[model samples]
Target chain A: MPLEAPVEVMLAASAGNVLVWVVWVVAALALLSSGIAVVLFTNPFYSALSLIGNLASLAVLYLLLSGEFVAGAQVIVYAGAIVIMFVFVLAYLGGRADAPWAGGPTLQAAAAVVAAAAIALEVIVVIALAAGDQLSDTAEVTGAFGSPAEIGDLFLSDHLLAFEATSIVLLVAAVGGVILGSAMPQRSKAGAD
Target chain B: MLGPGIAAYLILSVVLFATGAFGVLIRRSPLIILLALELMLNAGNLALIAFSRQLGNGDGQIFALTVMVVAAAEAVLGLGLIVAVSRKRVELDVDKLTTLSG
Candidate 1:
């Protein structure tokens, strides 16, 4: 009974527990708000804006998780490139803001819940399996979370084929994009007037 | 240590993926759907990195890199087609773009 009656010990544990709760609450709120914005906005520009905010928040989450490389990639490729492309396309293909054609608000929400459930289940299974057994001792390493040099070395070595294939894929995509983009109708000189 | 960890990262990714999936399913604009699809792919990237950290394996990071490259390529080509389609009809609405509607 004496061992369990330590006031100092309880105070320290409660402090730590409260801190964790606060952080988790904030992260959850940001993520959820962005998700709602993605749906609630009818204008495509606003939707793209919401998406950019979501990506930025996710990048912060990646950093908090000690994923420096991933955070960088999330910012550069996603926030920088992908969102910019989306904005550009929306601008280039100008149209008046019209009512969203997405039918049945209730149906959309229902489908979202089902899909979220499936993704959550898969994640739970993976985490459970991982916790049950020692898959690898790497995560336990003290300095393992943000090792960019090691990541770079592994990228050029063990994953060489994927790297090369990705380059090829990009090249083909660029060529195809150019050809297809150029083929779009040019307003005939006489028709323009 | 109330710092965020892999579990927090995972839950956030799941939420992002769900948002993207919802957008794809409900949005009638092809361009908006494409943007949402990118969001979903990004959610996958976050997971790959989280799992890579969990397993202490570099494979997840490598896979994520490949995915980014592929996503960029897809965006370029996909948008090109979208431009062509829009020019012909000035309709970004998915229902009208369908030439094969039965």
Candidate 2:
């Protein structure tokens, strides 16, 4: 509505929108670094670290996309909890260098290249679509969702089922991992004896 | 041209997703693969949120929230498996994990 008012008003609005674009650029750079990390690092530890950075960057990007609740959750769950779990497991497994890097034959490399090409093509399509006037919607992102009270309402009311499900899933996974990990030592000891 | 449109975000997400996919195909370490999987999932989440904002809907953000939880769960379970397997085998070579293949 405001953009349709007048030339001067539209110019003013566009000027104000520059702040959001600047943020977008910064977030994009962060995401880019994370992507490069994923490709270059063979070590799982380094990969995990890069993934953490990537997750944190994605969380900020989520904020820019107007998903404040998701953004905070991304940081807390992904960067905080899951990354810790990954690092712990990696340490227990004697780090990434000891793990196998080339598990398959030479064909896998070709496959990887093909897959990368396909992904690049998909991105090109998305870029073309975005350039056209196909998408017409509100760009306003709510800042209030990041507040405690509003977030609580959204968590309890709008997403109660999913929330409960996540807790249950995490509980199951924790117990299962422990059982599996603990059993290995005893099994190996029996074989040695 | 890339000021504030949905395409800029989409293109970026695609690159991120491609990198993750390439990592998945190239890397043999399950832990690294799992991390790559997380990257791919996050790329999808970015796309979803961007589209949701472009369409003025709350559902995309909601789905992205769910995906994050699932990704966490996946990482926990996945790493646990990696640790358990490594106790005896000592190394998790993708080629060596052929128990499933006939």
Winner by lDDT: 2
How do the residues A56-163 of candidate 2 rate in per-residue lDDT, one tens digit apiece?
778877777667777888888888888888888777666747333355456777888798879889777766775556654445655563444554676688888877
- Number of the top TM-score candidate: 2
For candidate 2, what is the DockQ-based docking class? Answer: medium
Query: How far off is residue A97 in model 1, in Å?
Result: 2.8
Residue A115 of model 1, lDDT score: 76
Top candidate when judged by DockQ against the true structure: 2
Interface RMSD of 1: 3.6
Error of 1 at A15 (Å): 8.9
DockQ value for model 2 = 0.58
Candidate 1 lDDT, A1-193, residue by residue in tens: 6776688788888897687667656756776687667655777788778877777776666655556776788779877887788788888987345344445556665776687667767766776577535423335534655567866787789887877888889889989988878854456534855
Worst 10 residues of 1 chain B by lDDT: B1-10
Task: Compose the digit string of candidate 1's lDDT tens values, residues B1-102.
Answer: 234556666767776777777777667778777877877888888878777877767688778877888888888888898897776665777757767687
List, for all models, the DockQ compared with the true complex.
0.50, 0.58
